[model samples]
Every structure is written in structure tokens, then in C-alpha cells.
Target: MSLLDSWTRDLHEAEDGTIRPTYRKGTGPGVIVIHELPGLTPAVIDFADEVVEAGFTVVLPHFFGHPEARSNPGTLTGALVQVCTSSEFTKLATGVTAPLADWLRSLARTLHAELGGPGVGALGMCFTGGFALATMVDESVAAAVVAQPSVPFAIGKKRAADLNLSPADTDAVVARAAAGCQVLGLRYRKDRATGTRFDTLRELLGDNFVGVEFEGKGHATLTEHRQQEAVDRVLEFFEEKLKG
Candidate 1:
């Protein structure tokens, strides 16, 4: 089915310069979905539609500036912007996931206040896997799903696997996961961008983290291959932890 046909909706979200074009739908409870670095594409919106179908209200925030990005797949996105002109990419690539951290927290808080104060779930992928975990610093967020998460700029270097999270922030989030919050991650075994990231989360979150590893797939699998399965599993993870 076409993405438009799949995610039937009348959107209620408005635009913000600080945030990429966003869309919200569904009713009862809340879940915030952050797009990957290339911005909110058709496949990404389709993910949101599926999550909304699962029953939680979904908000898909455009992480990169592809503000009007289409929902269909196979568009080539520029991963790195010239640091001199594009500060957002610079901030993200340099490990300053602070903007992301703050946005998720704020969005969660607002949803709780306006939407009966029920717990909120968060999902971030690739350039944003760590986002859901870090947002737990707020405590109001009940669950998170991190898919194909990687430290910033891992795509740039061929060698040297880095966690991409600030040492202090990673430590803090680890403590949250240890205490009570549930964190889940998904990745293909061969995707190097997320390999180091998954390794780091394993060290920090230990058994508290649930990882869904695909056998032969890689980075695109999360957004492409078996997407129905991906959305279902993530929704289950959220419901398991967030629902009363």
C-alpha cells in the first residue's frame, strides 16, 4: 500500500524552525518518535503511522532539515553538512546530542501534561538511538526503543568505533536503566555504525537492555526489510513497559 494510503490522517502539528516539520496523531497515552539523520522520510512517517495504529499517540519530529521530505524510500540524503554553514549537523556529529536530549524531554513533559499525564514512550533510530535513553533523565518517560543507534559521525571514519554519547550523559542514562527504566535496541549484526553503539549500551545497561539483532541484515533493514515486524516489536516493547 502507498504510504499515504497506509497512514490516513489529518495532521495537527505545526512547524518550528528549531524542529523539523512534525506530525502528530492517534489518541490516548503518548509516544514520541524521532527520525533518523536524513530527516523525516516516507518510511519514517510510515513507522509513525504504525506506532499510532498500535494505539499510542505518535509525534514524529524531523531531526535533520529535510523539512518537507517525502515518505517514500530510496532518496539519497546528505549525511554531513558543511560545519561552517550547518550548525545542527555539526552539533550532532560532534557528540553534542544535547539538543536532542532536551527536545525529547520537553516533548514528553508536554504530552504528559496535556494528555492526562500518562507515561510516555520514546523511539529513536540510527543518529538518535541514544536519544530515548538519555531522555530518561526526565523520569516521566516510561519506556524507550533504540533502533540502529550510533554515536555521531561513525559514518565518517572507517575505523575507531566510538559510543557517540558524552561520557557523563552515557553514565547518567546507564544509571537510569539500572534502577528501573526499560531500554530496548535493534540492529543488524553487520551494521558497523551501530555495532559500537550496541556494545557500549550493553556495557552500560547490561541485562536491563533488550537488543533485537537480525542475522544477515544491516543498516537499511530497520527502515526497509521486515518493517512490519520492526514496528510490531517496538510497539510490544512499549506496551509491555508503559501500559498499566
Candidate 2:
């Protein structure tokens, strides 16, 4: 049997008419777990399954790649090419939110409406990490987790410090942070892929930004590297924010 056999597959249409397949499972409060590059691999699915076991409904959206494909150099290259070339993502552009964030926000609203809680949770990893922060502009998302956000290629000083948000969206996120909405971020201290945006998050969100930095060189704290402590922290955050 496939790893996704338990998930109920469905199509979600965004406000801009973008349709994507989403796999869902579990019950209780809702959480949208966006996968890293190379699509929804087994590791990502396992993390999502943990979220379900933690007593929250989880949705895994299929953004790219063959679902359940293992992450390898070839798959990573293919997904990187797709992400770099796709018009939906903002890759190397600073101060601009990816157009794909609109779809994610739409999905958050749909989940919030379906579950009827304070709001839903959004977690994005690797290539899609900052997308979680982008979704926070909407009130429908209460708990946002950014795990190793890498965007704009982090090729330069400006791009490295950028939060992957437009001016308007940045202002909105700042306001939300000031209003007591906390954003949880996890990454390896020396992971260059994550860039210096965590510093920017600290500057912008101040104490509202909760960062969990590991002491080694590794990426994908909740997946590829798979730190149990980080996983526990994320679940604790979800329970406090979503269930409290």
C-alpha cells in the first residue's frame, strides 16, 4: 500500500482559479503541511502523520513532483528547475510575495471555515518555507511555522535578508505580530540555504517571532534532518495556539 492510502484526496481551487490536489487525514483542529522541494516525499508524509497523531487534522498539498517520490539529486534538480521557472513562485525577487501564497491563503480560509476554530495552522518547509509567513497576512491562519525558509536564491545581501513578502504584506505581518500573533521558525544555525531572514524576522516581529535554532549544519529540521526536539516543539506550539 502507498503511504498516502489513508489520506482522502481532493482538489482545491484557489481564488485565482489555480487548482491543486490536496491529501487530508485525521481530526480535531486543522493544519496545512506544505512539503519541501521534490514534492511530498515519505519523510514529509511521516511528519504530517505525526501531526495527525497529535490530534489535529492535517492537509498535505501536492505542489510539484510525483507524490511519494524519494528525494534524490535528480528529483531535487527537477523540482528546483520547476520552482525556478514557475511563474507562481518569486525565486530571486526581493520584496515580492510569491503568487502561490494567494492559493495557500485561500486554502487556509477554506480549512478555517470548515473547522470553525480560532484559525488554522500553516507549516512550510525548504522552498516553500516563507510561504507560511505569507499566509499569516490572513486572519484565517493563527499558527504559522516556517522550517528552513529558502527563497530568492539567497544569492545576495538583500535577498538573503528578505522575508519573501511584498511591502503591503510585510506591513500586515508586522501588524499581526505586534497584535500578538506569534510565528515559529526552526532551522540549523549554519544552514546557508535558510539565509539571514531569521534576523529579519527578529527585527520585524521582535519577541513575537519564536525561533528554534539547532547547533549543527543541517537543513529540513522536521523532515530530512528529522529532529525530535524540534518536532516536539512544533507540536507543543500547535497545541498551545490551536487548542488553547
Candidate 3:
């Protein structure tokens, strides 16, 4: 396996008939780190390890691609094709929530209940980024980070502006925002793939949405193009929200 860490691996079954392999490590409060579409590459695993090292139990669910696949253009393209063909994802649809988010929220609740903390932390990158927002409706997610959330692929203006959330989910998230549940978002200012979803987040959550925009074109805020500031902010966010 490309991931050479002491992680416990098991299968998780969702109520919606979805079963996925889960890799877990570390201890303390629970943090769910949902990987990008190219599958859980070494960089993704490394990011999860950082979260683990920051004094939190990290759960990484293999929602797509080979868990240990090496990152390359071909592998990334293959994973992209898989994501585009999957019915569970809303690859080209605007204003539609991906069906897999429900399963993720359920997983978060399970982890939080098991670990016993103020709540759980969720960090989603790439295609799964906005899933963190959807997970917030459950109230068990105390810290949510949306890093370079590129969904519906940002193929058009509307998709660019879409939050990949259903109307009900949007309302729930907005309510949480109003209730003081802060959502952290990070993306490059010129990353077209992210579109204007950050703008949408700003509009929806107002000041509750913390948008961290870096200059130039960059994605994978917590991974490949790792930003130390972003990493520190995420750890601080988890500490502030989940460690109490």
C-alpha cells in the first residue's frame, strides 16, 4: 500500500446501502477527512496524518479510486472519469446535492458519538469539498472546512455559483451559520474549478463563512499544494471548535 502508516482499516456500511472501506488513525476528538476525486493518494494520506498528529482521531473513507493509487495525470484522469460516470456524484448538475453526502453525514455522526467530544471536524477537498457543508446540518459537525471545493465541475456560470446543496440543506446550513457555526473555505483566487462557490458561501453564511483566498492558481489547499497557513488555520479551527 502506498500509505505506510499504522491505520486501522474496516468497512463502513451506510443506511443507504453504501459500503466503503475506512482507514482510521490517531486519538482524541474525531475528524473526518474526505479525499479528493483522484482517490486517496499519498498526499491526501499525508494531510490526514497531519490532522492525526494535531491531536485528533482521523477517519478517511475511500469513497472513490484506489485507496493507494499514486498521483499522476493518467490516474487522475481515470479517477475523474469514474467520478463523472458515478450516479452518486452530481458532476454536471447545478443546485443538486450529491447523494453520497447523506452517507458522509451519517459517518460523521457515528464517529462523533463514538469519540465523545464537543463535536466532530470535517475537511473535504476537491469534489468532496462541499460535502462538509452538507454534513453541518446534523449539528454533530462543529468544525467544517471546505478546501478548493470544485463541484458540478464549474462548467458554467450557474454551476460555478452552485453550492452543490439542496434547498433544504442550504437553509439548514444558513441556520447553523446564523447560530455561530463558522465554516472555513480556502481556494486560489484564480482557480476556475472552484468557480464562485466561495461567493455563494459568503452570500449564504455572511460573516460566518471564512473564505481564505490565496493569490495565483492553486488547488488542493491541504494537499499537493500544501499551504502552511491553511493547515495552521484548520488545526486552530478544530481546536477552537472540537477540542472544548
Candidate 4:
């Protein structure tokens, strides 16, 4: 059987009546794991499995692509184009939060209610990386991780600096950070795709933003060019923030 077949899948309905399929497993405080640009590939599933094994119920929303699909040039290009043209994502805009984040927040709320914990954890990678930060505006989100956030396509200086969040959302996140909710960030120092977003996060969240910067040009911190140190840091952050 395929690995995807082993996970439980359910359709989640948002407040707007839109429904999306979510793959979930494990037990404990909820953790919503958002996939990167090329969809929920095998690497993503493996990472989610790690989160599940760490003693938390994990929900992976299928925003795009086939589950368990292998990452390749063709699949990557197709997924990129789909997201770049979709209205749910702000592919080339700065200072604007994507509309899909609301749906994700709704999902988080539902999961948190079901799991009945202090709060929920969220990890967003690559194209969907900043989505985790945007979702943190909700009080239900306790642990938020942004890995290689490359939204707005990192087109220029402004795009690189933008947090992909609106002024109100940004203020809420900033206030939450000030209120003792720490945000975790992971990225490679030489990855141009990440741009200056990490720097902006540091400035916005100050010491509340714990950033783990790896050396060289690695973009996929949790998968692909997997980093053991980053994996350990992520699990530790979730445990400290969610399992406490």
C-alpha cells in the first residue's frame, strides 16, 4: 500500500463553505503542517510523520498537488504555476496576506477544539512558509514555524522584505510575539528565495523570533536537503510550546 493510503483523510469545511481535504494522524495537541510549493510530496509526509511521532496530532492540509507525489521538475513547475495564478495566494504582492490563511486558521480552530490542548502548533514551509506566521494572529496558534518563506515570489527588494501579512495582521503577530509567544524560523543564509524575510522577522519579533540560520544554499530545511539540526530544533520548539 502507498504511504498516503495509511493516513486518515477528511474533508474540512471552512466558514466560507469551502471544503478541503486534510490528512491527519497521531494523538495529542494539534499541529497543522502546511506543505510547500510542489504540494504534499513524500518528503512532506515523512516530516509530518516525524511530528506525529513526537507526540502530537498532525493535520496536513492539501492546498495543492497529489498526496505522496514525488517532487520533480515537471511537478514543481506545475504546482508553482497553479499557486502563482491562484487568487488564494498573493504571488507577487507585498504587505498582503493570502486569503487562504483564513481557511487555515479555521482549520486550526477546529483541530484545537477537538484536540483540547493549550493551543495548536503550525509549521509552514517554502511557498507556504509565511502562512504559519499569518495564522499566528489567532490566539489558538501557540507554536508557529516558518521555514524558507518565499512568498510574493521574492521578486524584488520590497517583496523580499514584506512579511506577506497586512498591517493589522502584522500588528497582531507583533503584539503576540511581545506577549511571550515565540515564533521559530529556519532558513539557509545563502538562499535567495528566502530573501530578507528572516531579517524582517527578527526586527518585528525581536527576541521573540528564534531564527535558526543554516550555512550555504539549502532551501528545503526540513525535507530534500534535510538538516538534522533543524529537525531537532523544530521538534524541540513544538514540545516546549505545545506539550507544556
* Most lDDT-accurate candidate: 2
Alpha-carbon lDDT, every model:
0.66, 0.93, 0.88, 0.91
* Runs off by more than 4 Å, candidate 4: none
Give candidate 2's whole-model lDDT: 0.93
Model 3, span 1-244: residue lDDT tens: 3474589998888788788889999999999999996889889988889888989999998877887777789888999888888898888787778888888888988898898877899888988998999888888898899999998788879988998898989999999889978999999899989999998999988899999998979887888888889899899999999886
lDDT of 1 at 201: 67
- Residue pairs with colliding backbones in model 3 are none
Sort by lDDT, best first: 2, 4, 3, 1
What is candidate 1's CA lDDT for residue 36?
71
The TM-score measured for candidate 4 stands at: 0.98
- Which stretches of model 1 miss by more than 4 angstroms? 1-21, 65-75, 82-85, 89-96, 155-161
Per-residue accuracy of model 4 over 127-154 as CA lDDT, tens digit each: 9999999999998899999999999778
- Candidate 1 — which pairs collide? 42-71, 151-164
lDDT of 3 at 164: 89
Cα RMSDs, all models: 4.2, 0.7, 1.2, 0.8
Clash totals for all models, in order? 2, 1, 0, 0
Off by over 4 Å in 2: none
Q: Return the candidate ranking by TM-score, descending.
A: 2, 4, 3, 1
For residues 1-244, could you state the per-residue lDDT of candidate 2 as single tens digits?
9999999999999988899999999999999999999999999999999999999999999988889999999999999888878899988889999999999999999999999888999999988999999998999999999999998778989999988999999999999878877999999999998889999999999999999999999998998898999999999999999999
Residue 174 CA error for candidate 4 (Å)? 0.3
